[model samples]
Target: MASIDSKVNLSTIPLVALNVTVRKKLGLYLNPKNIMGFSYLEITNFENFKNPTNEILKNWQAQRSEASVGKLLSILTEAERTDVVEDLRALIDEDVRKYIAFMEKKEDPPVQVPEVDSCVPRTPETLGLTVLDDPDGLYPERFDAFICYCQSDFPFVHEMIRELEQTDYKLKLCVFDRDVLPGSCVWTITSELIEKRCKRMVAVVSDEYLESDACDFQTKFALSLCPGARSKRLIPVIYKPMTKSFPSILRFLTVCDFTRPCTQSWFWVRLAKALSLP
Candidate 1:
């Protein structure tokens, strides 16, 4: 039987530099059983490099430095590097984070109906006269209403949807906070779901809504569907007092005023009637 030699020239070899012969001979770098001449073999102990915990993984993902990631990669073995890189990539991908944010924000409950149906009959006559007349049927209505509002006005929109649902008519609303799915592109969702499908666009008008780029985008897109000032496709609901700062395009449209306590019922009735719900 032939025995293999595992001797190394210590004078020239540095502990950090794992020469081919050393790597091949000691595949297991820090085996306690191996009486390798190096006294500080513990320094290269592979066990010391255990997989990071969820917290540490999150921290690494949060860091935006490519150089730092490269430094982390260089220290680990090829196999370990692959796993770490994958985990980090999954943790830090922009779309993945967006998906997570979408999921967290989209917690509103879906509309529910009572066990016994409401007596109010669903008929075309119940819908207001100002509602859009779809004679040509150019665009199939995807949602009862597409809600456009700022995050600040989300509470109002949320409550509004709840109120609308309780009425005889069940309003199918595309409220971004509740409608947009995880991993979906928000812009694409807006274009497909709100711009194309919704019969009416409901703008929760407020100072914040006007200030928000997203809210403005939805409002303008909805307006683009109906060019003239008399178009009933776009409905404005006054969530806050924005009379002074109201945009010109929205100024002409008949608005449902929920800003005043006295007009709150009127606003609800107006919106419900516009949606064809008795």
Candidate 2:
């Protein structure tokens, strides 16, 4: 294996790993017109360029020379690009893990790995966070809910999975991206999961959800299984602020709203209780 640099600049790693699609997304969110305090001319120039993503990233690096990967991740998270943030986080974690393994095998004294942020540690022992996976393979057959969400709201969905499935809630979720088998009819499989496989359906409500035809179908189908939410089968979670009114069909059903600051503390706990098996 090639020698690993002990004093690696963690900031550059994610920028280097970012694919074209992710870069484009970031470029849109980080554009000066979208975000305040950025030079209008500079961002406008980058936007008109053929490779705007690279130029935007380069500008960001120049502006915040000391900023770490965590800063970039935060920006992505704030921009509601949690999917990208999660991907970059995984990449960073894997890179750190590889570096740690390499250091362990060396005869030299333990090299101090630079800290990425408060969440990621400087030491090897603390950094080895347990992977959240079903080791015994028992939970595969059972799922608490089939999470209905659009691609844009996946960050909130990702956080929901972490809190509900990975934590003490211990509830299994049927997420299309993670659980759906390949080479199948999407509509057919989705209908089957909502109707039979999962005990409940979690509709991650947002402006995006309101616009998605698939989400509309899933919500309606789940409601059909249990009219008037008699068994509390469909849970609509208000994940983001919306200009559009709540779905008229689901207006009668109680919603778990995460947008409110008061609910943020107990949002997961409340959601877990609702998802728990009877």
Candidate 3:
């Protein structure tokens, strides 16, 4: 680094010459352990290199001299250069460090993305988190939710899921978290499950729900299935603040229009109470 830092790419030949020397010197220590000469072994050992290799490689490759990223960082005032490699050696050193760490962590079983705390960011596979197998390898034991709403109503339905989990309603409520990976592949499985085995349906209604494909499918499914053995199982929760009026079909069920209640503190209590009763 000291030998090549100032002259890096003032001439490419000097930079290449410096890297060859560094790589060879690095190989002397690395080669002995693997029984090959001139092998570039990382000083901190492989175990330390486990988890972050690809990310580091990505960062390193992103900073190589040919890239605009390197040029941009080079021009920055010292104080402003926060997320940059600074120079090629620093980038290489970072990659070597990450590579070593990744090797070290490699055998520890891939770290799973932590279980999402609330179902706000839930997916069919993620919500169906446990790796239990069906003969079909589809359904997990506990993820039975039917998310019913218009595409237009997902904004409110998005907020409603957060509020639902605050209660001990016990059922796994799935209002697709808009903030998670939007447009994820998991929706295909969710679409299948809702079409097949869902019992409880939470419909976030606006006039849009009455007009939309998602609403038409879910509500018609609910109205047809939610009777006799099913009883009054469909919960039509209103989202629009402008209107309290419901369509003649939906007017019969007890409803909570989020219009005023969503703004008040007691709304949570009332909402909790309503959810608690049925």
Candidate 4:
């Protein structure tokens, strides 16, 4: 069997090998808004293209030809689109997989991965907080917050999970993709989670979020729980800048503006503080 180079660029792969639907989905997922870090093919650099996937591939070949297929796979995995990642992996040639496996063994132990932001507190001590003793309390809440977001903004939601749940903050968030049980009604499950299970609600604000009827429903339901914004249970986080006017309902409430560079350094801390508050 001919050995494949571990460093083979994604651009060199035949388009026929990349399914059309998969290619289109990749193009969407690889957009700068969805992906964090420098390794991705920046779709913004290309303009006036009828077929974005083709253009993205062409540009990747011309400029970032050194980027490996493994890097592409890594990006999709980071985006938390495991289904898409699996589909892409299935399309990889057997020789390429063997080469990747070989390289994985030959490579040195991985370096300590850096936190997403140096400014964000990695431990509860750094944030001057202790883990909530929810179980011991009367009428203990099951979750810190129920994350309300559009499907398009899930990458940001994934980041939220990392900062809140995965870190020392150890906050349990009820996210639709992860928490909702299968074969259950989404509306019923979401309502129960928002009203009963979660103490607070986080509305991930973006252009796509504004258009989503499901997000609207979630936000409204959360608001009804705490009428007149008296409890501050609803937290609106603006991850992406919106072209449309901000929702009238959320306008009066304080927002965690992640879009602003000045606010980003303290965004997670602020959110964590808000969720932890009684």
How many collisions between residues are there in candidate 1? 1
Q: Tell me how many clashing residue pairs each candidate has.
A: 1, 0, 14, 0
- Per-residue CA lDDT of candidate 4, range 27-145, in tens? 66553343423334354433233344544554443345454455656665777878766655654555355445545664864577554775433332222111221111222226789
In model 4, the worst 10-residue window by lDDT is 127-136
Candidate 2 segments whose C-alpha is farther than 4 A from its true place: 1-140
Tens-digit lDDT string for candidate 3 (1-278): 43334433322221222223333433332332221111244322321322222212222332344422233234332435343333344645444444345445755755686656652434444443222212122223333355677677777655666565433443345554431234335444444345444545666777666666656666666666655424555666765653535666666676655666445666545554544443
Regions of candidate 1 where Cα sits further than 4 Å from its true position: 1-141, 229-231
Which consecutive 10 residues in model 3 have the weakest lDDT in total? Answer: 10-19
lDDT of 1 by residue, 18-131 (tens): 222322323333232222222344333322322112112222323323323224334443435454444433322332334334445557634764555444422333221111
Q: For residues 1-278, write the lDDT of model 2, one tens digit per residue.
A: 33235576555443333334555655554443333235767666555544455556645543555444556666666878786655555545555555445445655754774545854223332221112112222112346799999999999888987887666666778888886646555676677667656899999998888899999999999999897689999998997789998889998998898899987898888899998858
Residue-level error in angstroms, candidate 2, position 125 = 45
3 against 4, candidate with superior TM-score: 4
lDDT of 3: 0.45
lDDT of 3 at 167: 32
**lDDT of each structure?**
0.53, 0.67, 0.45, 0.67
Worst 10 residues of 1 by lDDT: 127-136
